[model samples]
Target chain A: MKIVLCVKQVPDTSDIKWTENNTIQREGLESIINPYDVYAFESALRLKNKYKNVNISALTMGPKQAEGMLRKLIAIGVDDAVLLSDKKFAGADTFATAKTIAAAIKSKLSDFDLIVCGQFAIDGDTAQTGPSIANFLDIPQVTYVKEVVGYEDGYLTVIRELDSGFEKVRVKLPALICVLQGEFEPVRARINGIIHSQQVEIPVYGIDDIGLSVEDAGLKGSPTYVNKAYRAPQKETECVFVESCEELAECIKKCGGICE
Target chain B: MSKGILVYSEITSDDYLHTVVFELANKAVELSKKMEDAPVMALVLTKPDLINEYKEAFQKSGFDKVFYVVDERFGTYRTDLFAKAAVQAVKQIDPEIMLVGATCQGRDLAPRISTALGTGLTADCTGLDILENGKFAATRPTFGGQLMATILCKKYPQMASVRPKVFKPSEVDVTRDTVFIKMSVDLDDYVPQIEVLEFTKKLVCDLNDLDSAKIIVAGGKGMKNAEGFALLKKLADKLGGCVGASRVAVEMGLAPQAVQIGQTGKTVSPKLYIACGISGALQHTIGMNSAEKIIAINTDKNAPIFDICDYGIVGDAFEIIPKLLEL
Candidate 1:
């Protein structure tokens, strides 16, 4: 089995702080592999462990600093790693990003059977890249996948999450699955694995390396524009405190919040 | 005549239009009014059995026209087929703005259609405004609710999706003259890459009905584990409400996305909201700020949840929830 997992490096939004003027202070914020992408990598690693002769490679497209993330993936047992780093790839939307990623996958790992990605990145939070990659590759894709249940004979069965409930479906080989952060727990790097990854040389691919022209790679390729970004307006509500749970119940009853 | 605003009236599995479509239609009507009363249209793709019902829905919902595709194959919501039909309709009609509900199916279908049409889609928009220049300015919380980005698509037929219950459904105007146009699209070229074999609809209302809950008892990262959620559920049961969760709880698997109340999840405005073990980050608060009254129960008095709640109780949720249950 041959697999490719798409990973992204994003600012850890949890520790984020807003400036006095209501703008995010980008300085000093740590960049980590997208939390959801960690699950995608973990899923691929689990599949590799389950099957024989599985070759898994993790890839990311970002600044040169993204090599750190790929290195971490290598430490956790991804067979190989590739970094799509170039100035031309900056400010790409999901559409352009998926195009560049599809080109890389086709040119580098043509015989790949499956591609896995996080359902959405915490930074952009657009769940479109993976499916858009499938569209560009002209392959099938299933998004919001909670679990990858079974794989056999070039077909994979997955449990997909729906607003109403869950759907069990089977997709053929040469497909892409976008994983949601569900029960799949991501693993840490072992000391031996860390030592081994340090010795591996990671490959970097540029815009030309992926067979894409500058016009098709970055901001020019993007169709959307962020006109403005600002802090959300806070609603004014004067809050009071209740000392005990009994007082809380009394307050709830008073607000007509408890329906008969 | 200029192209009008289009709303996709999504049909559910049980042969009824989803309420979010009506909500979108309401906004569409309001938006179209600003654009010189340029018509508000709807696109419905379904079987012939319920075509008239859907047409009636569009008419009642105040659409000026209903562009529909009727085929037996359209009974189930298939992304490949639906997006094809939708993109074809958009090409033919060429609407100025397109709105789709940010439901599970819509989230999947919209991106495919938008990508095919080379348009940008703003997902889970909490606010949509018609700029003075007439472009649609869509506002959505981004980066785990750290900032709200107001976006505009540089391309035509500006696309955006709104979460369910973000806007109120407009009152039906049964007297309006709504034209019904039957759009034809040949589905022979479409091969479904993914097939829905079976769907298991979870019957537990509390599991999926957090948006409509009058009272929502929500937990956050501090809930720690499944047992912590179990305690919140017990308190929710006593209050005759539902259990809600912050994005962290959902991310931690303490609760499912269905019950998650946050920027990434459902935007809820319950009558009374109880925050149990929730630290009250902006991401979680963005979804529940509209609640009529908020109660915070956390051991840390400085937890941000206390700042926004109307009633703050400084104590462990495990300890306080049991006391509340007894009360």
Candidate 2:
């Protein structure tokens, strides 16, 4: 089985800080492989363990600095890594990002059986990239996937988390699954693995290498534009609470006014 | 010439329309009223048998016209088939604005349809307004909900997928003369790639539907363990409300994903919200900040949750929760 997992390197959102201009301060914040993408990598590794002759390639689209993230994936046990980085691919939205990735998958690693991605990147929070990539690749996709049960005859059974309940879906081979952080625990990199990763040559794909026009690959191709970004105003209040539950219940009636 | 605003009537399999459909419809009606009272149309996709079952309800949904695709294959929610039908409808109607409920299915379908139509789509929007030029100004929380970004689409049929409960649904009336246009879609050409095997409902302790709950008792990472949420559930039961949790608690396995309130989870606006052990990150606060009243219980005095709450108690939830339960 051949698989390609799309990964992203994002600033650790929990430790993020904003500047006076409302721009993210990306300097001090440590950039790691998007936390959600690790679960996708883990899923592919599990499949590699289950099947014979399985190859997993981790791919990411970002700046030249993102090669460090690809190496991290290789260290964590990906068979190979590719960094789709170029100045032309900068400021791409989900649609343009998906377009570039689809082109990379076609040109670099064709005939892959599956594509796995994290449910959503914590930075963008769009959750649209995986589905858009699946659409660009003309493959079926299931998001919010909680579990990858197993592979059977020409189909993969997976559990999807929905709003009301869980649905067990069986998508044919050559499909994509957007994984969620569930039962799978991410594996750590070993000493030898880290050494081998640094030694592996990561190929960088530019827009010309991927056969994309300059106008179609980046900000120019994005249809939606961010007009403005502003801090959410803080709510004002004079908050009070009680020591005991009985007193708390009374406070709810007295202070809250609705807790009769 | 710019056409009127359009809505996708989101109906569940149980022959019920989702509350979000009406919420968007009401919002669309208001938007249209601002745009010289341009028609607010609804595109309803359902089985033939289910059309009459929901026709009058759709008529009262404040839409001036309803474009319905009634085919047997349309009975189930499949991305490829629905997107194709919807794209065809959008081409025929040429709506200036399209509103879809940001449910699981809508999130999947809207992007596919918008991409197919070569248009822009704003996802998971919390606010929608008409700009001076009549373009739909979609406002959504970005950067983990620390800031709100208002986006504008360069292409036509400016589309947005709005979260449920962002706006309240209007009351339904029986006498409204909402026009229904029956449409046909051929599904033979589009083959669905994914097959549904089985659907199982998860059994949790609370039957509370967080979307409409009047009172919500929510916990956070400070809840420590699953046992902490059990205490929240008890307090919620006493208040005749539901138990909600921050994304951290859901990620910590202290609560189910269904109960999580955050940028990635459900956006709720209850009458009274009692937050316990919640440090109130922007991601979690964005979902519940619309509540009419808020009360926070956290041991840390400087917890951000206190800044947003109407009333707050600086105490350990574990100690105070037990006392609140005695009543």
Candidate 2 clashing pairs, residues 3+ apart or interchain: A239-B311, A240-B312, A245-B323, A245-B324
- Strongest candidate by DockQ: 1
Give candidate 1 regions above 4 Å deviation: B171-175
- Reference-based TM-score of each model: 0.96, 0.95
State candidate 1's DockQ: 0.67
**TM-score of model 2 vs. true structure:** 0.95
Q: List the residue pairs that clash in candidate 1.
A: A240-B310
Q: How good is the docking of model 1, by CAPRI class?
A: medium
lDDT, candidate 2, residue A18? 83
